[model samples]
Target: MTTKERHKVLVLLGPTAVGKTRLSLELAAAYNAEIISGDSMQVYRGMDIGTAKITPAEMMGIPHHLIDIHDPQDPYSAAEFQEQGSRLIEEISSRGKLPFIVGGTGLYIESLCYGFQFSEAVADEAFRKEQDQFAEEHGALALHARLEAVDPVSAAKLHPNDRRRIIRALEIHHQTNTTLSASHAAQKKESPYDLCLIGLTMDRKILYKRIEDRIDSMLADGLVAEVKGLLENGYSRSLVSMQGLGYKEIAAYLAGELTLEEAVILLKRDTRRFAKRQLSWFRHMKEIEWIDVEGEQNFSENFSKIRAIIAGKFLSGLEYTSEQYN
Candidate 1:
């Protein structure tokens, strides 16, 4: 299909705390678009402070989709996000408004953009149980070492603590005699829409500082209280939602596994590592138009550059309804 015949999608992606939220609202208003969240953690209810979820006031009256749609116990995956995002794109486009996806969850955003077809490897429950037993008896690292022997690429991508994904990767290799990385590489990654992928980047030092400051603000805003509430309300510390970046560290502190200072340090370190990983993922995607905001604190100038890039990509003029940002 020609570009004109395809549906248009505008995506703003970056590492956490890289100013995507502020820019998303401005772009949404200027392009007369509705926003769809691309973050994995933001979908859960009552995960506001840690996820840095956009408040209703922060939304500035723009319609945002896929936020607070699930309880903490519910499972959400990239496949589900792809399905919902595709449907939302269609619905939003049908209404003569642009569909804008804004967040930093690389896998979910990439899967939706490129229509990634997940592997069809059937579950091997016995193998899963065996791996669980191994991890329980030996350690997560030992199980991870098994994957490192067979699929080093996947092992590198997964954290040592991410036992579920590590086991799942091993299961795929065990069941299909193929590594997860190979499965992904074999898929024909092609987008179903006229896509505009924008990525924001900045100097590492500055970005890391921003990350630390953001964590400090989250704590000051009662992140510990939020995690405590979740735990008190019977949310398991092992739940996927609780295992997210801010939630996990804070939960550890709440459980007395670590002191507040230790948790804060770990959270900051993990966030910096996560940002590095995010940059790695986006760098591999060839379609992204990267904008460097390094050392530039002015929002309007950065916004103008992005606006021009979008207009050039779509070959159309934006409405420019609003440009002022807080």
Candidate 2:
């Protein structure tokens, strides 16, 4: 399809605990839309509390796709996300309902929106294992430096803390004898969707408070027990799903690696750091319209402001969903 023929998509994305959930549901219901989750972990079954996966009641009758579609042990990559998400976008738009992409996984969402095509060379398990082990022996930064040597262009875009993607870059160079930067630059990819990205932000202090409180609520909602249940069911702690924020900390406590109090403290700290990384990623992206909510603003007022933004961008000044008033 041509640029003028691209499907319109609304992307609600930001750091964790930045309040994408309630607003997304309200917009979807108002616009007669279906949602496609842009979260990496939300695709895993039995990984709810830690991922902060939405409940059915919270969905409010809007159809949601690309979530709870994988077992915790299965591997899911941005390439897979792009393929699946593209299909869902077309499917939803074809039905005359708006297709909304909601979540904080930057690569998955951005690649889907911009039509990123993955290199076709199969992953070399032996090489990946070697790189991962090297990261453990040296450090993520050291591994990232390897990416810098092989593909500085790719390295420039990746965070040192993102060990996995760094490894993938190295692996790409290893297998394809071509740098990741070269592949992506060769494509010179462009936006495949007529998309508007709505990014939420707030005071750093306030966002950190929200992150801490959300972790507290996750624990109270059986985060520890959830991890315990997954382990008892024979899932490995090394699985990517189990390495998530809440799950990893609780797993450390369960393994006698840390006391419960210590684990919780680390959990909160790590999550705050993760939220920082998330914001950094989104800040680097293009075409994002930001909404910065005040600490003192009431929820209803905030929701009204959000609705107005969406109405202007998506609804073209038409009536919005007013029943639940979320």
Candidate 3:
């Protein structure tokens, strides 16, 4: 590969519990790759079990970046993920190493993949304070309705409960004199690398089953205890990381807002819904190579299929030794 032709990056994206971790490790090992996480929640430190972060033992000695890189109180956005992830991709590719972006955070992945132009609009505290005051007095729905009036496109994409993003959309419009939706639309397709977008899927029943099983595994791995520890460490339930699938439910349980049984049920249901949303997001993205993962095919077999596709597309001449994946 020549200087310009060598900048190839692989993206392995799918919904939660789709077996992305194992395959990512195998592919990273086989291709002399470094893993750059595409997960949004996994960036928070001390958010291990609930996030289902790739544990050190599971990483198989491959270097991974962007996991556990942020505090739970810190506000990490897709724009931040884009800036940091783009840098990692360039550095990894320049060193003749493949950068494998793996996880289910669709917004972060897509923004970085398409080279979305992130506005340098910083948070306007006074404007945000006014927005918050309005929300406090008028309620979240009322605040969201106000957003709908000014930037209907952004309002349509953001949920009423997402006060932060709603305020942000309003903030951007107030500070930049431009609508958030218009800025997004104005972004050009200026990706700097050749991308191989590999999507993983399975039968709906199997995928839902996997989601349930993964939730159970997370609880078994002490997700409740993890939540308690975070709260004890002064992390508030209002923090963005605390609102993630497992953490939110468990936090509610710990606060006596719900019984343990109810929390578990809610977590499972929410995770399934999240998985569906992830699929919906990916469906809207262009140029993805979808591969249906069979339920019966174990790791080695699945690895064979994925390896073949990736080799044909990105690493045409890179010879992978058998021991590499072992």
Clashing pairs in 3: none
Q: How many clashes show up per model?
A: 0, 0, 0
Worst 10 residues of 1 by lDDT: 317-326
**Alpha-carbon runs more than 4 Å astray in model 2:** 135-163, 176-189, 295-297, 311-326
What lDDT is reached at residue 252 by model 3?
Answer: 91
Please tell me which predicted candidate would have the highest lDDT against the true structure: 1
Candidate 2 structure quality by residue, lDDT tens digits, 187-229: 6447878777888889999999998898889889998899999
Order the candidate numbers by lDDT, best to worst: 1, 3, 2
Model 1, span 1-326: residue lDDT tens: 78667888999999998889888988998889999999999999999999999999888899999999999999788889999999999999999899999998888998999899887887889999999899889987899999999999888877776777888999999988999888777767688899999999999999999999999999999999999999999999777788788888988898799999999999999899999988988888899999888644678788988988887898463465664632
lDDT of 1 at 291: 89
Against the true structure, what is each candidate's TM-score? 0.94, 0.88, 0.89
Local distance difference test values of all predictions, in order: 0.89, 0.84, 0.85
**Could you say which candidate leads in TM-score?**
1
Assess candidate 2 and give its lDDT. Answer: 0.84
Two-way lDDT contest, 1 vs 2, winner = 1
